[model samples]
Target chain A: MSTTLTPKSSPIDSPDLRAWKSASGGGDTSQPPGLLSGAFLQETLAMTRRLFIQLQRRPSTLVAGVIQPLIWLFLFGALFQNVPQGLFGESSNYGQFLAAGIIVFTAFGGALNAGLPVMFDREFGFLNRFLVAPLASRYSIVVASAIFIAALSIVQTAAVITLSAFLGAGWPDPLGLALVVLILLTLVLGVTALSLGLTFALPGHIELIAVIFVTNLPLLFASTALVPLDFMPGWLQVVASLNPLTYAIEPIRYLYLHPDWSLGSVVLQSPWGSISLGVCLAVLIGFCAIALLAIQPLLRRRIA
Target chain B: MPPAVLIEKLKKSYGSVEAVKDVSLTIQPGEIFGLLGPNGAGKTTTIRCLCTLASPDSGNIEINGTSVVDDPKVARQSLGYIAQEVALDPVLTGRELLQLQADIYHIPRKVSRDRIPQMIDLLELTDWADKKTGTYSGGLKKRLDLALGLLHQPEVLVLDEPTVGLDIETRSAVWQFLRQLKAAGTTVLITSHYLEEVDALADRVAIIDNGVVIAAGTPNELKDRIGGDRITLRIREFTPDDEARSAQEMLARLPFVQEVIINSAQGNSLNLVVEPQSDALLSVQQSLKEAGLSTFGISQSRPSLDDVYLAATGRTLMDAELAAVGTRNLKKERKEAMKGT
Candidate 1:
């Protein structure tokens, strides 16, 4: 048998040796490894590896994730192909105008669904595997999911950006590309945090799916994904202005239209005020911070 | 020295139903301890509390003398728990799953590389280790679960119904593995409703019923405490009550016989509790012949653990199991299982 077997002789000759050997063997030792300890990093990496392995084996989620956004890009671009130039912003073509929205929305949608797998884990009792481990921090679970979802969002955004270029939605300059990645990352972090929060808060997968179902399409419609904020009614304009998705979308849209875009560039002209690029990025950062802060108690209750 | 595991006055409830109430147990180091109980008798709940998966409403759970409620991470590190239901992610291969487990336990890269193969070999899972667990048979899945549980080599290995749905061969293999584990000086705590599973494996047993430990001792100690050799005498196949009563009456007069009950449930078989003596079996047969009631079949043996349970709980384990079926709230139980500490 490959399994290591200890001899019948007792391993514990002294208290200190017993404690050291027990802890090294992953035996139940009495003290918690200190907070932010190496054990936390090991557990988080291991959990994140499991997610990656699942994604690799079941590649459908990845395939569909990329495919869904591309379909949105092609169909929505065709729908507005005949519209007059400059109607939706400074872009000469509608496809160019839609690229930024699709990039932001694709990452947003992917990040929003990040909690589904976690919710399923909870329902299926897989989370208990982690809960029972002597993890340094239970936040490792949340961190792993966030990291995996962020990586997936980055990949999907890259694909959407490449495909948009093929459809003649002009590419952003080198710095513009960097800004675009930053924006998608910020949006993903916040949305991923919210999704993970839902995973811990929701009772089961059915309830989570229902919540995702309602949030997915409505957020797209209300944001500047399919339509510019200037085109919406007075009430929807206010709603869109408040939507975090709009903040992510408008800055990317501004980047696509102006290669010389800086933080001072006006991204959206709301009824209340003109939102600057720096303000948009700050809103996204703030949204992520709040989303993370909001889920703390939920994670603590479940993990502690 | 502290026991390998100690649970004291552990209480937990789901809404109105108390799943576990005042459960106290102390399992010494390196012994195979069995928690025997009918369904809904709080065996799983007790295990859950010890494993740090669920917090007790009020109790102290210690793993190797460290408090579970106060230092759950340390308690968790000390124990390896295999739940009743296997929870492998179908998408990941068995090797990947074990790797994940090794990581969660913070097994070093070198140790994990060495240990994973050893576990696969120990469980006879080398052939199936690379396949997704979703495709594994029940036995194979269980073997993999056992591997995962043992990967960390925890001092106290806690399993809940380890072989509940396994085939006879698989169950035997698991029993053998547990014995091997015990030989290696690892403390094992297992819960099972199967009478023979406990009787055949446990070094010591605690019989729990209705959220409490009704009896606890070595199996022989409990059986011996009940006291008396049990003789089941069938006067004839499908013996009539009058004949059984007459035989029972005749048996009652014997000086060595302590008690007599006519079991009409089993064809009026006269159950006799007699003092252990050299001629006890022969005297019962001789008395039946004298009464002119032909002996159909008769067997005499020491009192079993069931008799001990019956003596303490006023009902057989089978009867308790049947009664528990109606009252078991499976949905409520599942929700409770999902509730983390």
Candidate 2:
């Protein structure tokens, strides 16, 4: 690149490149050829910044994200307020139990929408602009989206946590609150990867929305978010046990109820066996790993 | 010096439909090269392949001697592409979008700092730079699109149907900008279906038809190769078929007239291919009057790029464009467009 840069300075140079030759002053066209070069970081942050700007201007998604979970905690809690206390494993009220569910579900729903902007960009031909540019790595496209969704999921999780605290859904200790964020981030990462995978794998936004629709409600109901695992009959017990959301919600709910919890504390007693909080976090991590690994082929086909 | 942009036997297909086939062009530095064709004539496909938005089934595409397929990053750095559809983030102001463009191209901040505003001023987009792209008028969008493409000051600028839907005022503005870019030594590759667009801007052109290059040269070279002048004679604004046929026959019998065709789609206007430097225009006018038919409009001049297209394809560009409309599946094409093909 340095070798070629000399020509722009020569007398017989092409016209109009005066700005280009100088504007490119030192950062030449050739990149460092490493994945984490200055160029890679710059492009990723720029793309991420674009997403942030979008969220800042038209914040309907953020507003709705906060409101939806609040509605679940208040409205749905009132609907089930009369449930006998202690029928759901020592929680003084349904709101206490349902808080964990609302938080996890809200994060899950937000993660599911990670792909919509990208799909729209693809449909509108904006993604092609990225594809054609000398990007350090196309993975920045996915990472930018993951970062945006993760941030939004955290905000939504905060709202659910705060409102639940007012409803006597006991707040976790400092360590416990950190655990909740860790669990939520893991869950968001896994779900966001899958959503972005669907964005590239599916033909268009309509098909993607269809997949999200079919999976959204059924997963919520099947998970232990709204009810204890023991409340379900035999087959549903097994189904809820298999659900990833159950693993996330149980540990977080345990954090709220038992502030002195350790990694060895039992979080979920599935139909098969008792699972510790450490095991639950391990399962969420594993789920996230699988989701990330699963999307490689699709990402390669679409973006690379 | 290597050609500023080069392609050899490039071909790409979407499912079963071939978008580009056997297209090859070599553009030198500081010249404007046009890929002129109808809507589905493989112009955009070829550009897509060259720009690395779409991969080719088989062929070699290069920029400044670097193989695009092998080292696309370097090729991309050398080329800037303006797609037919100006896809901008509605929420981002024009300045924001330009900044993104600069970052993606990895332009130095110090350089882009001095440059982005320079480009905004050059493209007359400073007033609209702070506004969201969604509120921009069609012309404003196009100018911003041009500004985005030129921001990095790439060596080769590829514009796919640059002014397709612009008002004439903006179209001329873009044309004038391209000419200045060429004078400044940027290699420009533009694709257009408009006859005057290519004739007005291209230093050389490749006439693509149905995924193949049927003719290529400077516009005048192509026009001269077809070896005749064009004379359009409309007996009336909407002449009947019989009247057109009679006019065609009378024009064909003239000593200097080489060929005559009745353009039925254009109200049966008679198109004549006459010997160069001949007095056939006056004779045809005299004959029409002698035949007791008043000429509604009669014009004769050197063969246009469209005449070259006609001579090669046996159909005028307008006819080919109209024909391309029916067989083209719009939904399928839009889907392909999303794939950036």
Q: Best by DockQ, which number?
A: 1
* Chain A alone, TM-score per model: 0.88, 0.90
* Per-residue lDDT of candidate 1, residues B1-341 (tens digit): 99998888889876677888778888999899999988889998888778776678898888888898887777777788998988889988889999999888888888788778877866778788898899988888888998898888888899999999987667777887787777767899999998899999999999998788889999999989999999998878999888888888888999999999988789999889999898899999998888787989999998988888889988888899899887777987776556544
lDDT of each: 0.83, 0.85
- Docking class for candidate 1: acceptable
- For candidate 1, list the clashing residue pairs, or say none: A2-B118, A27-B78, A28-B77, A28-B78
Worst 10 residues of 1 chain A by lDDT: A5-14
| Cα shift from native, residue B120, model 2 (Å) | 1.2
Show model 1 residue runs off by greater than 4 Å: A1-24, A27-37, A302-304, B237-242, B262-268, B339-341
TM-score of each: 0.91, 0.90
Native contact fraction (fnat) of model 2: 0.43
* Tens digits of per-residue lDDT for model 1, A152-180: 88888888889888988778888988888
**Could you give the CAPRI-style class of model 2?**
acceptable
Model 1 residue A302 CA deviation (Å) reads 4.6
